[model samples]
Target chain A: MATIAVIDYGMGNLRSVGKALEHVDARSRILVTDDPATIRRADRVVLPGVGAIRECMAQLRRLELDAVIREVGSNKPFLGVCLGMQALLTTSEENGGMEALGMFPGEVRHFTACFAEAGVPTPGKVPHMGWNQVRQTRAHPLWRGIPDGSWFYFVHSYFVPLLDDAWTAGMTTYGLEFTAVIARENIIATQFHPEKSQTAGLALLANFTRWDGTA
Target chain B: MTLAKRIVPCLDVDQGRVVKGVKFVDIRDAGNPVEIAQRYDRAGADEITFLDITASSDGRETLVQVVEAVASEVFMPLTVGGGIRTPADIRRMLNAGADKVGINTAAIDNPDFVHQAAQRFGSQCIVVAIDAKRVSGADEPSRWEVFTHGGRRPTGIDAVSWAQRMAASGAGEILLTSMDRDGTREGFDISLTRAVSDAVPVPVIASGGVGCLQHLVEGVVGGGADAVLAASIFHFGEHTIAEAKAYMAAQGVVVRLAEDP
Candidate 1:
């Protein structure tokens, strides 16, 4: 049985993420843990987060789970959702500017001026709350069974602007084109909350469970 | 593509069971909140709001269990409201799997509660629920006044201005319900909904008095609401979420189609 460890540094909704994993695969052992040893032994790892980036990082550092995440997240089949995805970037403009795990070479920026600068119509709310379509930038395993242009539930203000297109897997338009999903070897992350994204989201999680970290 | 307008089914839970009533009176059991939430999830409800009518400490414990049950079964954003009084109450709900905490009376008691909660748990998770009643007369300046204590008392705060204040205070969304129209199914207070939605930059979930599918559409188009929250219409099986989405889609309002089961 594949054991997927959902790292619980105590910032995000760990239970829901664990429940979603359980709902997806009954055979897989969905362990919500903060112990570095348990995380290291797991076949796959998930980093989930919500709320302010500064607080999220503070908790990660306080628990010394930051180093564990850096080790387990880099080598294992990893998935990040919402703030988890944001924390993987090099830095975030939130809280004046905060350092991140830098797993993905990019910066998380607020959707403040992209719309106005592009001369597009008035963009939606700041948090960009609710469902929006994700346009797949490249083919990946996680897109299996989920149709193109399918809507996913999103609730965030800051988004990552990827410095390298090689890692960009999906993009969505809120203010302008913002990276919604990121994929590279052994990793898949999304700006949206897959646990709260309904059927399509469940499908993606199902795919993740079966994926071998290949694009 | 444009952002789809949401159809959220609200479950008023009392002591762990889903209940509904007329203007917050004569409450009766509907069904299991978790079962209903899963049904809505499969039927394509954009979100679910579980309002705990019993606001006591014991009630809070019951609601936490209810939320955990529903969260385990349903995979969608769940907003839990009803007696949230402090930042700790909000944190408890979120810890129990609620995506957002809807604050009403407590926010009215200490307006800064909204700011504090939003500041602590990102504004996206802080929703300010305003129960407003139309206070209009020929002699008086027609406006809606905020009501608390289950819509039994008036707080003298103008509905529109209060919404603006809450938004400025860091509330990410407004759950605006018209007291007069609530439970009547006459229709949502489009004028009041419009006023608040226009006043706040955040998403406004126009709630209360949704009698039919057209009201859902009207809630988004006419009321300018980002989402429509209905209780009785959905709870009583008078309307289905798929039916409502189909109705909204036909009206040229973008809505997610229910996945084939």
Candidate 2:
């Protein structure tokens, strides 16, 4: 059985992530501590978060889990969800000049400018809450069996812009084509909350559990 | 692009137990909230709204536990309402794992509460639930007035204006319920729904009077609501989320269908 360690950082939707993993028959455990040993020993790691990108990075740094996260992402199967995924970027426009986990060479920016340029009526909205579909960019193991144009639960205003096209696994349209999910080597992240996405979400979690930690 | 219609399952809970009744009377015990929530979650509900029907503050504690248990078991957004008065109550519900806290009677008593709660918790966390009843007048027969305190009192506030005010006051969403259409299984009031949806910029969840899948479809497409919230249709197993989504998709609405697991 796969022991999936879900990192909990006093943020959003940790229980749902853990429960979704359990539903997929994964031996899921919620890890609130920043101890490197626990993260190192886990078969897989799931980082789930919701909130401002800078606050999330600050918390991870304060708890000294950033190094451990880097170590785990370098070798093991690491899944970043929502803000957790955004934190993997190099920088975020939120909270004014805060560094991210730097797992991926990308920048997170608010959707206001993008939405305005797209001519959407409501721009600068803090939270984009609802169900939206993701358009797959290319084939990857993370989206192994899932069909293209599959809808996932989304609730965020900021989006990640990957430096390279190879990092974006899927893109979704709210105001414009934004990176909805990403994969690079051993690291996989989704802007959508798979936990709240029901069966498709569970299947995604199951796919992660079945991953052999190989790119 | 037309917005995707949402299928929401509403749980009328009292003292941690889900209660069902005809026209909101003779409440029969259904099941545990946690159990019911998991069932709905598996059934592919877009969202789940738990209305704590009990009036007492003591029931509030049970509601918190229900929210916590459901949050742990069910992997979906949870909106909890009923007896949520102050900003502290909203905070408590959010801290207890509720994604949104719904305010009803409090919003009627003091509309400022909506603005304050929205400012404090962000508009996304504050949902204003409006219960409206059709009132016949000398001028127009289709006049609607806001009802609060579990539909016991009439505030004489126009439902459309109330919805607009709530949105202006920073409410993220509106759960508009038709008191007359509730538990009737007759279908939603398209006029009331359209009025509220047209009045607010935020997402409007049309509640009450859902008998079949078509009603859900019309509630969104015709009624112009973002989501359709129902209780008996889902609680009685009249249709599953997949069936509902398929029906909506057939009707030309963009719905998120659950992939076979």
Which DockQ-derived CAPRI band holds candidate 1?
medium
Please report the candidate that would top DockQ against the real structure.
1
Interface RMSD (Cα, Å) for model 1? 2.2
Question: Residues A37-62, candidate 2, lDDT per residue (tens digit)?
Answer: 88788888988877556567767888
Docking quality class, candidate 2: acceptable
Model 1 lDDT at residue B26: 86
lDDT of 1 at A56: 91
* Model 2 per-residue lDDT tens digits across residues B48-160: 98988887889889898888888767777888988899877876787677878889989989999999886555566788999999887658757799987557788989898
DockQ of 1: 0.59
